[model samples]
Target: MLLDKDGILQDVIPPRPPLQSLDSLPGSLAQKVYASLKQAILSLAFRPGERMRKSEICEELGVSRSPVTEAMTRLASEGLVDIVPQAGTYVTRFSMAEIHEGAFLREALELAAIETVATSITEEQLVLLRRNLRIQEALVRDEDIAGFYEMDAQMHELILSFTGYRRLAFLAETSWVHVNRARRLNLPSPGRMQATLAEHKAIIAALEARDPHAAREATRHHLRQLIKFLEPLVHERPELFANH
Candidate 1:
């Protein structure tokens, strides 16, 4: 099932093909199934709070019940799904508390990362950042919201990578799952893409100037924008959010 941008309930749609090629993905059958399902949920193709039946999923993916059940269990552990006895499994609703928590963690880690790398960023790395911004500008012009969003994430990861702390990137990536869901739900808001491009340019400018404090501030501001965007959404689409 899916929910339209207006929060109206929509007819059920079969799961799209896995975002990544299954043959190229490195995982057992259960793990591959889990990855595919995770992407579906994150992309909102599965829809928040929609029930996920094992039989239906198996039929859609041409898989068996065991892999689908295992995948659902894994998703539940990641707080992406809830399994209720006798009630079946469901995609988890958005949680304001979780979103805030994720933002807090992401801000702290990313700030530290930028501060650490600001003074030492090599010219070569700066070139790559510039190239990314160029592509982002084109994406904005084309109104490729999904592509722009993906590049936004990659740019952050690139910044974090400069710190040489793989764990920092890993932590940021994990926290991003929650944030990305919220962003995707609230996407295509008027002028949001342009504003995002401007914000990203500011962060890059700070990096170019080798100003850690400025970069940290820009990154924080960028991350917080999502929270502001979501606050009104929670009120307008209460059905999409959890009670707690």
Candidate 2:
């Protein structure tokens, strides 16, 4: 893997094989299996550090052993789950250090992406971004945490996508797969979520004015907010990091 200056993966010389790509139409057994497991892990239905039995997963998901195996393999590759030899598979546990590192790395990449995008973002792109922010604000007010999170992900993805850095976007996305649960929890906190929307408004203002420096700062501030939001949880539940 080639890393960028910000320490994000830029490219994989021998790219990892693609996992099951289920569409809105219909999906293969493996794809369906992967989707189900991914959701359960994200929603905390399969709690952190919980052991996962292949047989149990197969029975619960109503799939065969092969699809469960494939899903577990894919989730393991993404760092969402772990496969311990001879013991059992387990959902990856949260760690204070890993959480901080992820937030820091994401901060750097997003700041860079914002700066890059601000320099070239068009009026049309600005319109679309503002529209996203509006929807996000409404969703946040409705306490629609999940919907707001999806829009938040889309907002960041849009910035990277429009900036013409698909490789960097791909790397950032993979990293997000590991930390999305924490990110989702961050949005439900009152003060943190309010600050998030304010930051989004500031970012939009900077982008609209074509101020690259302000846009970068806004992005950095937004990402750093997660560190403070998650601090209490990690401190109270120190056991979460024992295995890490």
Candidate 3:
């Protein structure tokens, strides 16, 4: 806790997202099961390294053994779960090595997207982006870290959408499955959520100026901040990491 303007000490705890219902989820049975598990895992509702009881999940989602089996297989492929033959299914633990690799790949893709959008973005797109930023700012104020996180993903996907490359967003999401889950740890750090908003604004400012170099720089700087913010977790919260 830090002193406020009036010198009063205050408690500062970050709120976690609640677990979402698995009922009535849309898609094919397997697809719906996959989406539900993915969201829970990504939001840290299913804690990293915690055992996944397939029977419990099947009963909760009202799904059969086959759909649950298919979802577990797919999640394992995505690095979201580990299937231990004798032990149990478990949420994958954070690995700094994997996170670094994911960051490198994302930076390469986003820099290219930034340059593309800087030149080609239309006014309608800017309006959508600005609206997103407004919501991000409010989330930061509310200290609604989970809400802000979803908005953050939306803004990135929106920028990629502006590039008119239909497959780029899918590529980015699929490629960084581990990094996406690990990012849940970084945002709630002291001042990090607000700092993210500021960085996002800088990117938008550069985009509005129609300056590719500046926009690319903004995107690079924003992506690099992830590692900086996450570095402390390796030492401070060792249980969050694999092989700790």
Measured against the true structure, the TM-scores of the candidates, in listed sequence, are: 0.91, 0.82, 0.89
lDDT of 1 by residue, 70-173 (tens): 98998999999999999999999999999999999888898889998898999999999999999999999997888998898899989999999878888887
Task: Report the error of model 3 at residue 210, Å.
Answer: 0.5
Off by over 4 Å in 2: 1-27
Candidate 1 CA-lDDT value: 0.84
lDDT of 2 at 3: 23
CA shift of 12, model 3, Å: 16
Arranged by TM-score with the best first, the candidates are 1, 3, 2
Evaluation by lDDT, superior candidate among 2 and 3:
3
Clashing pairs in 1: none
The models' CA-based lDDT, in order, is: 0.84, 0.74, 0.84
* Candidate 2 local lDDT, residue 46: 70
TM-score of 2: 0.82
RMSD of model 2 against the true structure: 10.0
For candidate 2, lDDT tens digit of each residue in 1-244? 1223343432223422232234431578787888877877775557678787888776665667998899899999878898999999998888666676666677777888889888999989988999999998898788676687778788888888887876887878666664666665556555555677788889889999889999988888777777776677665555444453
Better of 1 and 3 by TM-score: 1
Name the top TM-score candidate.
1
Q: Write the per-residue lDDT of candidate 3 for residues 1-244, one digit (tens) a residue.
A: 1223343333443333443566557778788888888898987778778888888887777768898889999999988899999898999988999999998988899999999999998999999999999999999889888799999999999999999899999988876777888777777567778789999999999999999999999999998988886777687667768888
